[model samples]
Target: MRLNPLGDFIDDDTFALLQQHRLFDAKSVRDFQIRKTYREMRKKMTASDALDKLQELHPYLQYDTIRKIVYMSKAS
Candidate 1:
């Protein structure tokens, strides 16, 4: 599969850069970054703070989606 296929709902720049690489697909890259970012944010901020920061950085990101991912991961 193409790592940075056209349907991953990521920023264009990120997709373009990933498309340039040959090793990882978009899913791998996105999952890796999400975990990394979530871990770091947890170390320094409450979930509310992290959500605020993410909104500031990416206004399009829905907090609901992030909240679901966090809780679902914990449940698993």
Candidate 2:
């Protein structure tokens, strides 16, 4: 479980295993990428601006929904 440059949590072998077992979690991977992108954006702009930019990238999600996803605990 090292994080790759692309923010993937599992190594290729583990990813392959998970895929083979049909246990790969697409939603969790998407959330992780969203959080990673948000953190990187925060370093260059205000939180509000970052959220707005993220919202632009994901028009299906509301601002508050992105806010919750950005701030949500890892255990969730």
lDDT of 1 by residue, 1-76 (tens): 4444444477767767766785456554554455556778989999888767765654665778665544555443
lDDT of every model, 2 decimals: 0.62, 0.80
* Span of ten consecutive residues with least summed lDDT in model 2: 1-10
> What local lDDT does model 1 show for residue 11?
70
What number of clashing residue pairs does each candidate have, in the order they appear?
Answer: 2, 0
Q: Which prediction has the highest lDDT against the true structure?
A: 2
In model 2, the runs with Cα more than 4 Å from the true position are: 1-8
The deviation in Å at residue 26 for candidate 1 is 1.7
Question: Quick one: RMSD of model 1?
Answer: 8.4
Q: List, residue by residue over 1-76, the lDDT tens digit for candidate 2.
A: 4434333555777776676797857676767778988999989999999999999998998899899989998774
lDDT, candidate 1, at 4 = 40
